[model samples]
Target: MASREFKDHYREQRIFVNRTIAAVLVVFMMICVLAARYYYLQVVQHDVFSTLSDRNRMQLQPITPTRGLIYDRNGVLLADNQPTFSLTIVKERVSDMEETLTSLSDLIEITPEDLASFEKRLYQRRRSYESVTLKTRLTEDEIARIAVNRHLLSGVEVEAELIRYYPQGEDFAHMLGYVGRISEQELKNVDPANYSGTQYYGKLGVEGHYEELLHGKAGFQTVETDVRGRVLRVLEKVAPAPGADISLHIDTELQKVAVQALGERKGAVVAIDPSTGGILALVSTPSFDPNLFVTGIDTASYQALQSSPAIPLFNRALRGQYPPGSTIKPFIGLAGLDTEKVNTGTTVWDPGYYQLKGDDRKYRDWKRQGHGWVDLKAAIAESCDVYFYDLGYRMGVDPMFDYMYRFGFGQLTAYDIDNAREGILPSKEWKRGMKGLPWFPGDSINMSIGQGFMLTTPLQLATGAAVLANRGKWVAPRLIRTINEVEVTDVPSPEDVKVNQEWYWDYIIKAMEEVMHGRHGTARGSARGAEYRMAGKTGTAQVIGIKQGERYDADAIAEEYRDHGLYIGFAPVNNPRIALAVVVENGGGGSSAAAPVARKVFDAYLVGSTQLQAAN
Candidate 1:
């Protein structure tokens, strides 16, 4: 029995020895594999491994710079950046997102918009580890509440964002424009790299015109973070460069004066410094607060603005096209004299109406009882329709069209602003092309009186008046005096577009002076008692067609169907300093309504009557 036990024990020991040998072999092979991997990573694949390690541990972040401020000519801040609080979400750090969001909402009030906005941002961002904005312009109370409950919430954070705020608000809204959040369309159009750190861009006017110069370059920083996506420390930072400053040519004081002067009246007044094409004051009535458009405008509010009868959203000063009425008479008078159709000594007989040979339609004169016989200077001074009718027949439509084109009529003024419409300058060819109709003699007669297919913008009229005042020199109108801190010099005078004899300019200017100073002058009512000579023309354009035999009267017509008062003029007959144009929609009598507005603008501009209620 003892011998058998010994043999069994010996066999068990042999089996144990073989198993131990196999286990040792496996352990040696595992160590060899680990050693080989270490050699490959540390030596052969050093760069690849190092890069992966760095990416896992380090982060790159953008540092947005402060946007430059904007100020008016008088140093009043037009656009400014104010600190605002916004709630953001860090996607990667979030666990149980619904629970986290619920906890956050409990702390701070989150609207349906907040949740909708968050979902939009989540889909827009590619990286789950990245953070996006959930809400903007959070109230102070909301911020404090969120901060207190921050410990309960994960992946939620508050950030300070510089938001654009207009202190003047609605006052200079159209002129200054406003900035807003960039849209998808804009993202496609703009350089994503350049606008990476920029949240807002200028949309129109001065803001849009200088977007590139105002939007500074973006910068980045290296940061270290943990696996949970928590930034531990900033490794290296590159400070961002700020945008350049822009100074406008507009004077705030003048703008305010003009805005107030145009109170309650649906009209436009554009006044400029004649020496330079610097737009001193541009007023378009019923202007809305541009701030409303900066942030997303609500549907109700947008609809209200759009539906408003006053059309507060329209930029009438830069865009409104209207028949210049009789305002172009002075130019036509000049045209007539320049063409030698009517010299200074030329005279015409007026029998209260004008007839074209056999045409029974009497082109009636404004003065029903005509001033029997009048010279060219007297005719312009009195706004004699019959006198101009004769000149129109003699000068022909082609010559008149060519002359007016030189005066910037029916053409865009090439102002340093966008969206200026080129008012129509009708010709035989233009009529045939645009209206698909043959030119008529009656069209020529109407065109001669600044009517028919001819049209002009308020800006164009003001600029044309300036050119006349400057003695045949057209200066491109401008709203911004300087850009990117670089001062813009006076625009060079346009090459003289000869319309008439050089000596004829003197006769026309003298006659225009007489229109303001002469007893029979139609605009004499408003022109009287001016400190300096203001050569001007007053026009009452018929909004509704007058019957062949019916005389137009404001008291007899519906308020909406009444005539529109129009005035175009320049100050100081000899050394013209300011040129202006005023249009009052449905306001009767150019002398009583529109001329006074022009007088007020001229007074405020040239004589410095910033505060005055002079005779209307």
Candidate 2:
């Protein structure tokens, strides 16, 4: 109202026109900016957004390969596979982990142990979107229950998987071993990609040795999944390759015989085919059922095995380190002949005991009143310790250690034998290093008798006997005969023992034969009425050391403190076929306790062969 008096009509018209032009220009710029943004989002970043959208529905899943089958030489199925259903959960698909587990418990029996194990693996290293097992071996009723409540539960599914099953149960557990849940420590070592969907792997024995060959390649499938993580339909599929089937050198017939021979006693027995250097039988008594360990063993059960007085978990054939006792006499005899320390005519007078020149300690023999005049042959045949005691004292510890090491003692016997122990072969240097003491002549005497620090496994003794049977030709022992029906005898070239005289082999072998056939032979009772000739040696090792003058009375001491009986033998002395080593824990004597087991094994294997040849 105040400016009305000075009104300029032309100027106002110009101002109105300028304002309309500026408004139109601003509207045009805003429309261009919006159009450019729309184009960039739709055309340039199209694939990126499409992938994010597809991720909500599509998923990649891993397929576990079929594990290999295990068999004995006679085509007996040792390890098998059975279909099983397990409760599994994918954490990413779940909303509340605690709530889901609680709800699942209402649907099925979720044991405290199950919840604990699931919680433990919740944070373990795993592939993206991989399912964690909550419980295994779901029953049919549980499956039905889960299906009925599927709509309410998220990230839960019943997965069908193949579980390891043992057809022979406990008979071949230690040899074949069992698969178990992947431990957290083991997970750190294995390739995560290779074990994508796999839960169990070999934990011991042959299974562990051949894990790569047994666990086949993993495959994958791209599939459409629902919001709850249930597979709707497969978009793409890649089938996994099955593992190779393997056949071991073990004979089911011979293995059974070995187990039966041991009876209820806790012992170990190993039998080898001298010709092929094949392991025919391996037996460890008080064996546990392998199936119990395949899928995670419970804490209580595991603790029981770990705490048992018998130590059933231990693999004695490959790992038990015990004194060879008098069974080493034959090998000592061979060492003596090879070293020129003693010959066939070399004889030592035994007046019940042996004595070092300056020492008053009496190293007594099995016979209180020993053989009056004992040569190398009589020494071996009668298991005379006094005669060898003098020979070993003269030969010294290092010399015997070298010879014994060559026979696979104090060293792993075979390349493929998993965890085969290298038993102790005591020497002057060993005594100083291990015990911080100088070697003495009495120490040599004890070493000669396979006592003191000298130790050997049953497998080593059997391997040694096989070498003797082969007449110094060494063939590295093998467990597997074939893989996928193809020969897998990947044995290294053996170093055949070349002695000073080839006749030395025959002389020692002949002396061993007398131990089974001669009237005064230590193992004569066990070899009575044998159709074919055989060579053998007996051994008895003390569990508790006897004092300098104390005589061992088995009746007075506890049974657990009794001597461990041992024997090494082979059948058909001239054309040796089967060589074996037997160890009977807490057994009174080798001749009575261990030799009989070897005899039965020999009769079963050799007699069957004889009958088969006659029939053919």
Candidate 3:
């Protein structure tokens, strides 16, 4: 038995065979597992893996559409798009932001303001991968320098883009407004999908009012990029739809004439086409260049504009609320005729002042020795305050408010542009609401002369004059004449201001005509040597309150406190074509300062029309 156990070679061979079988089974199991994983990755999840890989190498980039071109009615370019270079940075790609900014500062002339603005925008940015503009309107030399050092500067890029440009500069600043870097608030309001690549947005005027139409639909492109996120090639692209080119009712020639006419003065002039209610010219002097605002205006420049006494940024035409003065006389006269409170033949005795039934307060007239015994026609033509004061007392505040409201007063007249003020047409209700006081007979007296609580913007006055010129047919004023070659006819129609006597319009219009052509016309000097007949009314709005029986002494008052000169007029009285309103801030009188401005605008339009007619 011992000899048998020592020689057991078969047993050893059996053990070796079992070990070999176990090793083979383990190797086969591992191979099957590896094959299953390969199948899952290559076939089952192919699309998922492919997308992840593509995301790493390819980028979907937004292509900004070119902003619309703005042109005057005569095809004069007001706003245009110009090619500009901008330096941008992506925070995610950058190794160190401060280091990158420092390096860029060394390469280019980066002001402290630029750095501050950039840092602000960097914090405000939505994403780390999105490029933030560091500096705009980069020079050629700056671009070349950045390109040479591109390898060292990781997230920095110089991109060429189209920026808004105002060719008319300061002249059209307020009317066309200006585009500026999108603010944090603006970003919240804007459609992220549409404005992904757009950096600038309209801040004011027509630019703001028609921002949707001006900012075209954005497009996209698939770009092949390297590991460093540098674009290697544009794999596919979808061209962006350019913004609609807009044509305004503004006549550049007329605008220039109006601007020139208002030279060196703090004033506003608004001219409209009576037939179409198209704004021909809108001028607010002491204007600053809109170009300054396009690419983030520097603090110093902005401060200068903000702090200047002239108020260059103020849109006086649409926002300045001043007493209508004598300008509202014609409208008041219309109201009188409509209510039967006073007819065309109604007369009142004038002794240079008006008293409300035994009250000591004597509302003085512009003429110290007023036109003796004035009727409605002579009252408006001579601007006799006594007659209107009596008229206002008779009609009271309710009827006056009603009639004025009908003429687009105490409300927005031009719906086309944004920020137009609805001037105050002081009524008993308005006085109670605003000043918390009862409407007195004296209040009515003041309202009658276009004084106490009676306010009107230059735009409103022009719109009212147009209404009068159109013989009570109201047409809301508009700036946009056409959009993308299609004429815009969606302007709001005027409400019918019906009167008891239809001939009342003609009667008041004839009285206004006398104010321009009659011997005793208030604006007689302004109408001298006119080619065609014009209807007009002169006004002097007091800047400061005058005491009872106290004469308005211009020399005693501060320059800013001097009376504002105002005039409302329409040319070719028989068939009115142009209706205009002029206001000179701190000007001594309407006839001297404001009427001349109206004359210049009238001459430019009427003479130009005559020339065009002869040419045809």
Candidate 4:
């Protein structure tokens, strides 16, 4: 309908004005809503949004500190760090792990062991977004291949890191130990924050004993990154503190000489500096290269080491327990003299065999016809079994056990070395506990001869010899000479083995001298042409027991069943400088097999010390 009147036209104009006002109001409300939303985002949650945005472009990375240097006493490097490249993978960045691994294999030679080790680390508890090492010690060609195929590999990165290297190789394998990748069990015990950037840890020997001082503190750096997660620029940085430098008391030249002396023999040698109680040389023959273990030994090589009959990986010097045999005669003689069970003039008549009061079992002596009318000195020098048999029978087991215990037998030496075994020192109570058997007279006799139910480690033997050399002073053996130019002086000292007569030590020392220089001495042949006077004792440990009426036939028995030869000695009787113990597995005689080895060690240490003193 058309409103022709003036009032109707005015109403239409009013209606048009109202419609315009409504449209304007609607526009103004929408503007207000938009302004409120902007204010909420920019002001209310501004800090939270800003932080999230920055996180996408910035990252915190851990910096591994340099592992400390290891050196011999003379500054020869033992353990070192070498720059090497490794292939790493970030799980979060990879879409398909298996597919990515397969693709990466084409670019680099990825072994099955690498994949297995990577998969093992993948399931282990680790930080999110952290990269995992897939293959370590990457070659230059492999690194170039990966760099060329960078676009094809999304989660992969070629990272450079320091790897552990052993310069001395097998020479210090057991003593220096070797570092390897952090084990799952070790990771559980280590501090997560401190070990975040660290990979390897000490597995054995001194390296294991000083792991804390060797593994340095970890540092961190804040860096700017692009959308692709590549570092753009450094924002802030914190430098890590390097590990403390360690210096061992080991002499490299002496170690070489000892190894050379033990050539072609399956045995162990341990030499110590008597004055400072520092370990000079520790050699276990048929040693394997520790470098192989550091970079992860291959399955075949590791299996070969584990399965070999020679057992090259065994740390015989620290862990092997052998029957002490006749090498214990000097200590037993001292025990006899100290206890007054026998005096210097006391004598025993031997007829090649000994018998207990009523027992018909005749214990045969090593000599078919024994040394007649032997005194304490002659018994020790001649290695007369019958003389000790009578003395041991008279002293019984308790006194012998007490005396041997004072000499550090049957218990851990408590030395600075790791994994030092406490060899068996049989006692009445021990027998009851171990074998559920009562103490017998035959057991005492056997023990006095250092046979049957009694055992000792080469370290224990050497330490015992050092105690004798020190004239009853108990100085614990140590490996670390100093740390970072500061001498290590907190070594524990055991109480002295006080004797009723101090001169008894001199008497025993004089008798030991005879074992090397005397015309009738057991080891006199090996001690020939020596420029310096030395005190020594030789031992033959029986491997197989003969029947009551049968004689030992080495030719009839297997080589493994042959007797183990042992020798213990200290140099320059007037002023002792070195004490040593040598054990040759399946070697026939102590004088022929083990004593010759000691002669070489003595020559090396004594002569070398003189030369060193002259040079200084």
Q: Residues 1-616, candidate 3: write the lDDT tens digits.
A: 5555376789889999999999998998888888899999999999999998998888888888889999988788999999989999988889898898899889999998888888888888463367989999998899999999999999889988889999899889989999998888898998887888788999999999999899999888899989889999999999888889999989887898899999999999999998888898999998989999898999999999999999999999999999989999998898888888887678999988877767787888888987789899999999999999999989999988988888888898686889989888888777899899999988888888889888999999998899989988888899999999799988877697788888888888899999988999988999999999999999999889988768889998789999999999998998888999999999889999999999999988888665423321
Q: Model 4 segments beyond 4 Å from truth?
A: 1-41, 608-616
Q: Candidate 2 lDDT, tens digit per residue, 1-616?
A: 5655777999999999999999988998888888888878888878988887778888878999999998887778988889999999988888898888888889889887788888887788888889999999999999999999988888888989999999987889888889988878888888887788888899887788888888888899999976666779999999988888998888877888899999988899999888888898888887898999886778898899999999998988988888899999988899999999998899999999998777788999989988999999999999899998999988998779888877888877685679888888888888899999999888889888889988889999999989888988888888888899998766883688778999998898888899999989999999898999999999999889988778899999999999999999898987888899999989878999999999999888888665323321
Arrange candidates by lDDT, descending. 3, 4, 2, 1
Provide the lDDT at 599 for model 4: 94
> Poorest 10 consecutive residues of model 2 by lDDT?
607-616
What is candidate 4's lDDT per residue for 358-438, written digit by digit as tens?
A: 999999899978788999999999999999999999999998999889988888765567777888999999999999999
Please say which candidate is ahead in lDDT: 1 or 4. Answer: 4
lDDT of 1: 0.78
Q: What is the TM-score (0 to 1) of candidate 4?
A: 0.94
Per-residue lDDT of model 1, residues 1-616, tens digit only = 5555335887899999999999999999998899999899899999998988987888777766667777765566788888888888887778888888888777777777668756765665233344677778899899988888777667788888888888877668777777876666776787766666556778877777777767777777788987755679999998877876777667776677677777888888887667778776777887888777664565678899999988988878878888777888888888877767877778899998899987888988888998789988888788888888888888778888988888887777655677668888899999899889998888888878787787788888888888888888767778766666678885655566565367677777787887778887877877767888888888777778888888887788778888888888888888887788888888887888898787777777666753322211
Clashes of 2: 0
Better of 1 and 2 by TM-score: 2
C-alpha local distance difference test of each model: 0.78, 0.88, 0.89, 0.88
lDDT of 1 at 526: 78
Q: Which stretches of candidate 2 lie over 4 Å from their true place?
A: 1-36, 608-616
Candidate 2 global lDDT: 0.88
